[model samples]
Structure formats: structure tokens, C-alpha cells
Target: MSKKFTIPSHSEIQNAKSNRNNPTPAIFQKRKQSEQPNESIIEENVPKQSSEKVMNKTSTFRSFQSDSKPTVPTVTPVSANSSQSPEKAVDKSGTYRSFETVNRPQKPLVSTTTPLLVNSKQRGNPILKHIHNVAWEYSDIVPDYILGQTTCALFLSLRYHQLHPGYIHERLKLLGRTFELRVLLAQVDIKDSSHICQQLANICLLADCTLILAFTPEEAGRYLELYKAFENKPPDLIMEKSEESFEAKLIDTLTSVKKINKTDAITLYSTFGSVKNIFTATEEDLSLCSGIGPLKAKRLHKAFNEPFIKNIKKKAIEEVNSTEVKEKCEKGIGNENDNENEGC
Candidate 1:
């Protein structure tokens, strides 16, 4: 008593298809393929290697449908056996592309042999450029390491608002520690720089700077003489004393040797210390000290060498008389002078 479903005949199905465009399985598949064309379009637009070959193919198979100038179009994919030729499709898709916009980088104008500053464009600090150049120029005289240390010390002092004293002292101390005596001594000879000498002298007094003193035997000997002279004299010589000072002795020495007046001589001595030091000092350096002029310096130089010069008039009085005879003669002369004064 079960009823069975009957299958429709082919004529009935054909009549229904003619009546409506209903999408069966095959039509539905075609519709789906048409909806998604992005991948196919991208693949079709990909250019073949050579544009010339594609252009030739386009000309051969293509017909001018319009009398107007034909513009080349981008290519789309076509089946090999389809009515669309590969050349026409490749040309139409613009896949025979030879056009490219590449960026070409510029070359630097550096040569292998160019100098450091010029080639590297390392202008350095404008203010320090001269100093840097000078350092390199005399690298043989002053090593890079020492120059760097000195410059750094100077910069630090400036930044800290320090005077030249601490900077100079520390640097000289470092030099001593490093045992750069020869260089230090050479620097002591700098006529244009007495700060270096003054610092060295202070170091010697402090007993902290030993390298320079040890390196040069001659300078050491001179320094020894100076020390001995200091020790034998009163502290007043170097310090303030009511009776006498180092300044006074120095003035006396200069006055004795130079035959200058007490005031001018004291001024010169106070300014330059000793006869020898004054004589040896350059005019410019002496002028900076105080109360020194070209004339004074010249006169001092002459006075310093006077001891060796012949003074005939003063030599006769220096002859030694026998002690007994000299006393009797002095007595006789005094009595005669007294009688003559009494008569007047």
C-alpha cells in the first residue's frame, strides 16, 4: 500500500527549461566562474619577456575596426585554441611592458688618495680646527696622546671656571708622574711662556716635580746653587722681614754689580731677582716683569760684565800695605787734618 515517486520525462524537463532560465548545476558553475575573475585578470596581465614579438603578432592578427588611431590596451588571458590570439591578447593586456622607472643612486666624489679632512668632510670643531691641524702638523714634536691630554685638561679647566694655576700644576704633575722630563725642560725654555717656568719652579720647591730636575744634570746643578743660596740666607730673603728680605739681597746684588742707584737697582732686582737672571732675560720678557726698559736692560748687561773689564784708576788703591805701617800713617794723617781744621 506504499506510493512510489514517478520520474519526469525528458520532454517535460525540456519544456520547463524553455519556459524559465533556471540555473541547473552546469549554469550555476558557469555563474560562479564569472563572479570571481581577479586571479585570472592578474595572470593575464603579466607581460611576456619581449614586447617586440607581441607587437608583431598584434599587427599580423589584428584588424582595424575603427578609422581612429588605435591605442594599445592591457592584455587579458585567452585560451590557446580560442579566437583571441596570444599576441593580440598580450598586446591588449599591455603585458609586453618594457617601461620601467628605476631610481639611480648618485656616486660620492671621494678618491682613494684624498686627505682625511678633505675626503671625509670632517671639518671638526671650527674653533678647534686650527688646534687639531697644528697638533697633526707637529705630531713628531708633541705626541697625539700628550696633546689630547693637554687640550682636555684646558677644556676642563675652562668649564670649571678655574685659573691657569690648577691646570698647569696638575698637568706638570702628570708629566712628572709619567717621567716626561726632557719634554718639560724643553718647554721651560719657552721665552713666550713663563707660566711653564713658574710652575716648574713651584714644583721644585714643593719637592713633587722630580723628573725634569733629574733629567738635565746642568739644570740640576744650577738649581742646587740656587737652593744653597737660599738656605744660607735669612728667610726674609723669600719672606717679608722688617730688617731684610730676599728682595733686598737680590737688589743689593744687582746694585753692586750694575752700579745703578738703589731705587732703580732695587726696582730691577725686585722685578728680575738676580743680576744673571736679569742679564739673560730677553727684552720682551724683562719688560713684562716691571720697571725694565731697553736702556735699563742694556745698562744691566754692561754692569754684569764690568767685573772682568779693566778699571785702571781703581786698581792702584787696592794694594795691600803692611798693617803696622798703615796704622802709623793713618794716625799721622788724622793729626795733620785736625790741626789744619783748628786754624781755619
Candidate 2:
């Protein structure tokens, strides 16, 4: 069988071809002359009157701005040689003022004189002078507060002793007395109680008085008991001396001669059997003792080796002999001068 085909009309064929070649308005314009040439045509067609109006508006705005705007005052730089304080610097024209100079006041100069620390009365007191010297010597070990408390305690204790002649013996009699004094003072709320106790202990030690083993409150009651037990006992006689242990005597001797602390004394005694052994011990041996470094050992050795009493006696005898010989020589020279005068 033969099939018949439907033919497109001329108009339909032309429309379809046009749509395929230029589907959108942009593509159709692109096929013509460039779009830049059209832009010039548009700008030429625009009215000159609109441009003139815009220029006139801009000119009016500029004039309004010039009239309404504020004027800024000119600022001159300040000079180094200006006749004004550093706080009050003057500008080159001398018109502008500094806020600091106007608002702030000048500070006064400070005094240079050193204020006196000790009063005249303290200086006069030998005890106070001694304490001050001790505090200075041991400044590294003792603090200012401790030193102050010690001074106050010593003053009060000495004052009390003076007021009560027989009550406070010439020497501190018992170690328990330190605790008793502390307990008596505790109710008064003394400042730095521990330091005060330590100072009192040191004073008692210097006076050759017995001292408490510890400064704790717990030991205070024990001290009271000891005081009661020893209260009835008669005072120790000078002639009838109590037998002190060898170690105690050794420690006392070491402390007195070497000026060492109790710990160092004990260490020395422990290392060497007796005081004689300690004195005889070389610096190396002394250094081997615990807590005694080479420096302290050298000092200990020097103190022991020093001929203190022997040197003093020898010096005294030499001085006397020299004086006698000088007197005899002077007499002899006077006799010779007389003989010469007689001959003349």
C-alpha cells in the first residue's frame, strides 16, 4: 500500500526557521550591529535640560555646605624652651592651656632628715644598749618583732625585780620560774607570747638560771608541779655546790668559751668524749661534728688555741719590767749629765 505525506505550508516553514535561528530577542539583536552603538544613540536622545538641572542642584548643595560647616581653630606646636612648667606647656602662640596645669596642684618636697629610733632614756640604759647590740649581731636569726617583744619583756621583768627586792632573787633560782612568769602574764594577753617566752628563756639562761625544757602550754602544768616540789627546799649554798654532770659542765664551758649554741655544743661533745678532747681536736675533726661547718670549726679551733690568760699575764709583766728599766736608764743618764756639768 502507498502512504501519502502531509506537506508544511510556506508560512509555517518560515516561522519554524526563524524560531530556530533566533530563539530569543538577545540572539536576534546580536546578529545585527553591536549594542554599544545603540547606547550612544540613547545618550544623545536624552534631554540636555535634565543634565543642566543636576548641575544646578550640585552647585546649590556645595554652596549650602560651605555656609553651614564650622571653622576649625589652628593649633600651634609647643616649643621646648617655653617659659612654663612641664605640667603646664605653652603653645607657640601661647593661647592653648593644658588641662593638667589648670586642674592639678604641685606636690610639696619631702623632708630628708632621718628620724631618731631610740629615745634618750633607752640610750642611757646599759641593759638596753646590750640588748640592742645583741639584736644587731643576730639580726639574721632574729626578726624585728621578736627583738621588740624581747626588749619590752626584759624591761618589765627587770622593773618587777627592782620593785620586789627579795621576791626576785639576785639570780633566777629555778627553771620553772620562767613558765610561772609566762603563766602569770598569759591572763594579760601579751603580744607574741612565744617570742616573749623565748626572750625570757634567753635572759634566764644568761643569768645561770634553770630553764624549762619546752615552752608549750602543756609543759606549764608540769612546771607548776616541779615548783611545788622544790618550793620547800632550802637555797643552795655557795660552799656546798651541787654535783653537776660532766656533760653539763662541758656544754657550759663550750658555750661560754666558743660562743656556740646548745645544739652545736652537744654535737661537739657527742663527737668528742670531753671538753679537753674537743679543744685538742683539729679543725678537720671539729668540722666532722654535725651542724659545725668548716667556718664554725675554724672559729672553734681559734678560740680554743688563743692564749687568753697567759698572754694577759705575760703582757702585764713585760710592761712592768720595761717601765722599771726605763726609770733606771733615765737615772743613769741624769748622773752622767751631772758629771759632765761638774767637769765643764
Candidate 3:
């Protein structure tokens, strides 16, 4: 038997090739379009060196860039009136601003010891002549004289206080809490000195300042000198003679009598050597003491021996003696009217 042969059209041929996994013309065109990068895609590869490129731009690295390009951040231009503010200079220097550590300058150390401070105004003061024992120099200080680190001195003349009574008060207020031991040296220059001195003493007491009364400027200077000289010494140096001595006690004892003054008592003690001997001495011996006059001596002698009787008994005895004397006179006269007094 003879078989009949048939020819397929081009469209049928393409459909058969496609079913067999053979690449068709449309599929090949799509593959070529994918392999050949788009011009827009290729132009997107702008880099740091567009003019001086290191590699060929037709590199295989640019093949899938259009499909797999990373989402690049869009940059917006800032306007002049934008709310954004420039960084502050302090923010950079302060903490948490930068990774680098911020180092601050350190403070200098203060000393525990300080030099003696004297007011510059006291340069020509005569009291400065006495401040030689301690090392001192001039300074623009507050107090009139800074004796020690915690001690100071303020001078006030009684005359000046009389003129400007509140001057010392102003000065005391100026001291404030600076000095622990404040001294006010007062020179008694006025005639009515005791009353003003007492007022100053009270002022010093309330102001916590020690008051030193001076009659002369030199004496005041000497006090300032002693304070500096004994600044570091123990307080017991002045506490030695706190109690009265034997001579002072004896003098006070002998002066207890109303008539016996201090000089008279001393004279009597020197003459008799003891209290018993002084009382036992005769009136003539008491008179022989230098200050005891004859009247004082006789009165002192009588005081020791006199009886302690009431004035009524002594007056009654004197009245009886006067009556007896009157009766004797009447008897001697022998008068009639005096007969009533005969019984007397």
C-alpha cells in the first residue's frame, strides 16, 4: 500500500518546536532584551569616578543591576528658612556628644597654712614697732591687725570713742566671723574715762572681743607684742599666778579694820611681826608704829578691853552718881527747901 505525505505550515512548526523545549524567535528576542541592559539602567551607574573609570562600564557586574538595584536614599535640598539648627559648640565639648572623652582642667590645691595678715593701712602705726617677734608683712586685709590666723586686734582711744561712740561698734561689725579671738585695745585719754571704759567693756563683752585698758600708747603696743609672742605657747603660761600670793592675802587680812588702812596695817605687821603680837601690843607700842596715831592707838586699845554693855545700864549708873553728888551739895548748904531732899 502507498502512504500520502503532508507538509506543516510555519505556525504549526513553531508550536511543535515550542512544545519540544526548542527556543522560538519570540523567546530568543526576550532573552536578548534581558541580556542587553537598558540604556536607562546602564546610565544609572554613576559613581565617584565617572570620568576616570577603573573598569569597563559594560562589565557583567551591571547585568542584573536594573532588577536587583538597592533602594537608594533620596536626598532633598534644604531651604534657608528651615527649622533645622546648627550644632552648638558646647554640645561637642560636653558629655555624650562625641566618642572622644572630654577632659576638664583641674583646680589648684589650697594650702592649710597662711601667712600673718596685716592691714596695709597699719604700716605707719606706732604699734607696729612692737610686732617684731613674729614674721609679718603688709597686706590688703580687712582687720586692723591680724595677730594670728584666727586672732586679730582693733585699737580704740577713749577720746576717739567719746567723739565717735559708734566707731567701735562699726569696727566690731566689720570683724564678722573672721576672728575667733578679737581684742579691743582702749587707751583712756579722756578725763571722764571710767564711765566710757565701762561702756566699752560692755561693748567688747557683747561683741566677743577682749578689752585691754591702756593709759599710754606704749602700753597698748606692749599688749599687742605679747599676744603675738605667745600665739603658739600654752595657755598655762598665764595661768601660773591665777591665785593671790601670801603677801597679798596677808595685806588684805590686816586691812579689814575700819580705821586700819593698808599702809597702817603693813606698818603694824612690820613692827609686831604677827596678828597676836599686834593686838597684844601696848597703846604706847601701837603709837610707836609709823602710821598709827595716838588717838587711833588709844581707841584700838580700848576696843580690845572695853565691855560689851547696853547704853541703858551705863546711863542709869551715871544718873545715880549725879544724884549722890547733888545730895552732898544740898547737905553742905543746909537749906530748908532742901529738907525734902534730906532723905536723899
Candidate 4:
């Protein structure tokens, strides 16, 4: 078996050799270049030298950051000697009761040694006695209505009529008719006090008898002291014949006159020392007494100045002497007639 072989044309064989030796046309070559990467293309795909250098520095920083980071220190746990169960904690059941504090009853702080208020019978202070005595003259003499009118007048007059202690005592002594004074006081009590002065005027009654009395501050004090001593004690005018008796009499006289609606009378009694003194008192002097109004004082002055018994006595004495002389002359004539008849 002999095989027949077809031979390639010389042009064809030369074209094959030329195609292998020479590059293709520009268009075909460009297509082939595009399809495959050259050295420049490969370099463009890779970073430039500066960028590669920066990448190297970033890698160094990452490594340094990883190495420089701080680490937490590890702590080892301690072991117990034995794993014994914990002992049960004991709790106390004892009660802590607060003590009951009782408050004691407080006692009143009174002193046992203090003295009682029992009155003593000793002499009282003399100055107090004097002041009380003086105040009584104002009270006994001055009425509430006329106090303002006669204040200065009474004050000056009373001040002027300053009695010595001895004189005060003597004046009180003379007015010490205690029984008669008490009777007068009791009668005045029975009478209607409002009509006492009026009734006396209507009846034309004279004061049955005049009580001579005097007032002074010392007398008031003495009476106060007497009352203090004898008050609540038994009455015995004779047995209690002390200074108190005299003081009682003085009080009686004063109280009687006061009760008779005659404060003016009492005031006059105080100033003049007796009814006689008031009877003789001038209008000006009586006017100075407290409660004596101008008209009443003037009336009293006129009444006193007009002598009652004094004038009557003078006239009676003159009549009696004249009658005695006339009787003697008639007796002598009758004697001559009897002689002539006997001779005939």
C-alpha cells in the first residue's frame, strides 16, 4: 500500500513562515494586545513606589499597635486549708427591757418654822397713830359735798389749831360722859335721820343738853388703838377703866353727833371744843368749818350773836331792883299814915 501525500504550495509555505516571523496588522495586533497584558499594563495594575512605601508603613504601625497594647495582670486565687462547712451563727434571744421609771410625788415646800399671824398686844407705832388722828379731823368735820369748797380753809385752820398732846388729853377727858353719850347715840338711831333736823325745827326744840366734844388726829389714833385692844373682848366699863374707856367716850360723842344729820354740828364741836364755843363763834369763823354753806354760816353767826339768856337776865335784874325800890317808898308812906291815924 503506497500512501499519496499532497504537497503545500510554495506561496503558502512562505506565507506561513512570514506569519510566524512578522507581527499581525495594527488593528489585529491591537485587538491581541488588548486581550493580553504587557509589562506597562501589569505595572499599572500594581501600586506606585510611593503608595507601596505607605502600605509598608501602615503594616508597621499595625504591628506596633498590636505589640504596645496594655495587658490585664492575672491574679491567682487563694486556697482554704479545708472546705469545712461554715458554723451556724448563733443569735441571742435575751430581752432588753427598759426599766419602768416611776416619778415620785412632789411635796409642797412649806417651812415648818414660820410663825403664825397671831396679833400681839404691844404698843403700835406713834407716827401711824398721829397720821390717823389728823385724817379723822377731816373725815369727821368735812362732808363729801363740801370738801372741795373748804379744803384750803379747813386745812389752814386745823393746822393753826395744833393742840399739844396734854391739851388733847384734857379736852377728851372733859367730854367723857360715856353713859349719857351712848343714850344719845341710841336715841338718834331710833329717830328717822332724814327728818331729824326738820323735826327739831318744827318742834322748836333746843338741844336737850349739849355734848362738849373735841376732835384731833391724836385722839383718832388713840381711839383706833383702843379699838384694836378691846374689840371682841367682853364689855366691862368699870373693869376696863383704862385709856380705852376714855377713847370709847370720845367715839360715842363723835358718833352721836355724826348720826344726827349734824356733820356740821360735829365739825363745829371739833373746832370750838364745845357748844359754848360754837354759840360764841362769829360768822366768819363758823364759815371756815367744813360743810357750813355761806347762808347757813351767816344764819348761825346771827343766832349766836343775838344773846338769848344773857339779854333776858339783864332785863330781869333791872326790873327786880326797881320793884324793890318802889316797895320801900310805899312802905315808908304807909308807916306815916299809920302814925297819923293813931294820933287822930
Q: Highest lDDT: which candidate? A: 3
Instruction: Give a tens-digit lDDT track for model 1, residues 1-344.
Output: 99999999999999998868754688878899788756446436645535455557665422223337567685454654777544454555446532121234556776332111111221242223423222122222221122222111111112221235465456444444433221222213223344544545665557443323222334433433333234335566677545367666765666664436577766766666666777777656654645666676676666654566487546645443344446656566557675455342
Question: Candidate 3's residue-wise lDDT over 27-146, tens digit each?
Answer: 888898888866666556555454324246545444333356555444333345765433222332242231123345556686444455678876786666765655677888778777
* C-alpha lDDT of residue 255 in model 3: 64
Worst 10 residues of 4 by lDDT: 145-154
Residue 274's lDDT in candidate 1: 67
In order, candidate lDDTs are: 0.45, 0.52, 0.71, 0.43
**Alpha carbon lDDT at 284, candidate 2:** 96
- In model 4, the Cα lDDT at residue 2 comes to 100
Backbone clash pairs for candidate 2 read: 175-210
How would you order the candidates by TM-score, starting with the best? 3, 2, 4, 1
lDDT of 3: 0.71
Sort the predicted structures by lDDT, highest score first: 3, 2, 1, 4
By lDDT, the better pick of 2 and 3 is: 3
Per-residue C-alpha lDDT of model 2 across residues 219-331, encoded as one tens digit per residue: 43343334333433556732567448887777777787554888999888877877779889999999887788898888899898987776887899989977866766666
What TM-score would each prediction reach against the true structure?
Answer: 0.19, 0.26, 0.37, 0.19
- Residue 270 lDDT in model 3? 82
Model 4 vs. true fold: TM: 0.19
* Candidate 1 global TM-score: 0.19
Worst 10 residues of 1 by lDDT: 148-157
